[model samples]
Target: MTPEGKALSNIVILGFGFMLMFTAFQTCGNIEQTVIKSLNNFTASGYTSMSIIYGVFSASNLVAPSVVAVVGPQLSMFFSGLLYSAYIAMFIQPRVWSFYTASVLVGFGAAVLWTAQGNVLAINSTDTTIGRNSGIFWALLQFSLFFGNLYIYLAWQGHDHISEKDRQTVFISLTVISLIGCFLFFLIRKPDPSEPTPSETSEAPLHTESTDSASVSGPPRRSLCTQALDAFVKACKLSVTKEMMLLCLPIMYTGLELTFYSGVYGTCIGAMTRFGHNAKGLIGISGILIGVGEILGGGVFGILNNNRLGRNPVVLLGLLIHYLAFYLIFLNIAPDAPQAPEEGTDLQAYMTPNVGVALFCSFLLGLGDSCFNTQLLSIIGFLYKEDSAPAFAVFKFIQSIMAAIAFSYSNVLQLPWQLLLLVVTGFMGTLSFFMAEWGVVAKRRDSDYDSI
Candidate 1:
């Protein structure tokens, strides 16, 4: 097959595998807080476990580039998939010790999984095709939202609360689904090293220098520990670059907002008594709507935005939409919604809660999330083509740290307070993104002028 065909095939396989895996994981995650809270005596256990997951994920990213470089993306992904499966299977019994232990392990696994994913995707793409490839991958991956949540809604509708028996059955089914996805990783083909890259000519000398140094026979081949430490140091340096520094806020914003829609907002919907006893089931509906919004946004920004509109406009659009969603969430949901159910508290916001409006806000949040993520993926791929693994590791490091912080506070913060934080961060992140874009343009223009 042609190199392009092979590249496209790898992307499709990766997308399908992720869709299946995350469909199961995310479906379980969407209900994790509510379900775990229901089965266990501790109400905050769900939030705390999630916090641990992201915290470990944040630290693990420091070493993820080294792991990816040593094992390669396919094996890294396959092994990480196992960790995710272990985490999901724990829901069957739901012990605090077992659950939290799995959370820590899964956190480490997540760092490797995501970094390897970015590394592989970057390897398979060039500047011209990266956006479209990212879009195709994202669109397929986000479809998990539709299929998984639809099942949850159907299986869970009309239930006031999830039962232990129901939880067991749900998790067992999801575990099987995730395992199938994991096996698909074995089928992926690595990109040929011989394939041409836009930066290949410029980067050849660097590769040659490293190879020559390694071949001197004066020292043993760098051990995995040494390699990992080197990669970790490189990622740290990359994180402090002017371009990466400018992009940090926007990167961190993705983490914060991602935690919101993925876990917190759905919890609020579940806790809302105004939606009736079936409100708990409405989390599935919200997930579905959010999935719809995410799929649409991924298609537009990732696929359609390829060479047309610049990234900054798409990010600004995301910011505006998120602001709208936040306003509606503030008006329609209770101020203390994140902390307690309506039955637990008498508080209400400016307007009475409406299920329709709540779902719409979820949709908007999903759409905006896609805009930010797709653009960020493309931007990183374009700018750091040669250093894709370490660059992506740096991005994930900052993103996961913010996610860890957000999850830590998710249960403690009221709904209004959370919305306020998002609004402020969204503004700052958008402005930073614009600055980064401007810098890239100016740098490129100068390079072009110098060449003439």
Candidate 2:
């Protein structure tokens, strides 16, 4: 096959593998708070576990570049997948010790997995194709939300609460599915360094210095600790740049919104008793709609990009849609919905909860999220193709920290206050993103003038 064809094939394989693993994990994650609460009636256990995962994920991003540099992206992904599998398997028994311990491990795994993922995607793409490739991968990865939720809806149909036998069976099946996905990492062929990058002609390459020796023959033996320290320093330097500093606000917003839409909103849907006994199952339906919205957003923004369009407009559009979503969520759902289950008479929402409106809001949340992520991926890929690993690590680091903060407060804040925070952050993030994009454009224009 041609090199171009081979590159596309690798991208597909990577996307599919993630779809399988996350389909299992995301589905489990959507209900983690509710499930844990059901088991022990402690509201904080599930949120606490999620907080730990993102907290560790935030710290681990510092080392992810070093790990990916030494192991290569392919191997890094495989090992990270193992960590994901172990975490998912912990749901079978759901012990505090085992669950929290697994959470910490998976947090580290998630950092490596995402940083390596960015490296592989960056290497496979070119100046113009990065947007399209990011779109394809995101669209494919989000399929997990649809398939996993569909399974939950079916397996959990007619039952208000999950039974022990059924819960065990569900988790076991998901574990096997995740393992199958991990095996696909072995099939990926690393990108050849000879491939062209946007940085080759216009600027100095940003590839991590230590990994320069990685070649077809094999990487040279070096002290693992030394390589790690060097990579960490590189990441820190990149993080302080004006461009990176500007982008941090938007990056952090993505993490906060991710937790809101994926975990908090779904839990709110599950806690509503006004819809009757089967209300909890609405979480599954909401997941399906979210997947659909995300796919549509990815297709429009990621896959269908042209020179006429740009990242800033897409981000602004996301901000508007999120405002609409927050408005609906604020009015339609009660402040206390996420706190505990609410009966028909006990409910005190601004407007009575309607399944249709709630589901529509879910769709909007997913669509807005897609807009932010695909654009961020495209922006980072275009601007830092040479330093892809550490650049992505910085993005993930900020994002995970914000996510940890959001999860930490998920149990404490009411729905209205949470919505307020998201609204304000969305506005600030979009403005900051616009500033960053403008700076990039201005810098490029100056470079072109210099060449003249």
lDDT scores for all predictions? Answer: 0.83, 0.83
Tens digits of per-residue lDDT for model 2, 313-406: 8999999999999999998887887767423234657888888999999999999999999989988988888788889999999999999999
RMSD of each: 3.7, 3.0
Cα deviation of 184, candidate 1, in Å: 1.2
For model 1, what is the error of residue 338's alpha carbon versus the real structure, in angstroms, after optimal superposition? Answer: 1.4
Clashing pairs in 2: 206-386, 207-386
lDDT of 1 by residue, 189-297 (tens): 6555577566333333222222234345323346645756777787888888998999999999999998999999988888887888777778889999898989999
* TM-score for each candidate, following the candidate numbering: 0.93, 0.93
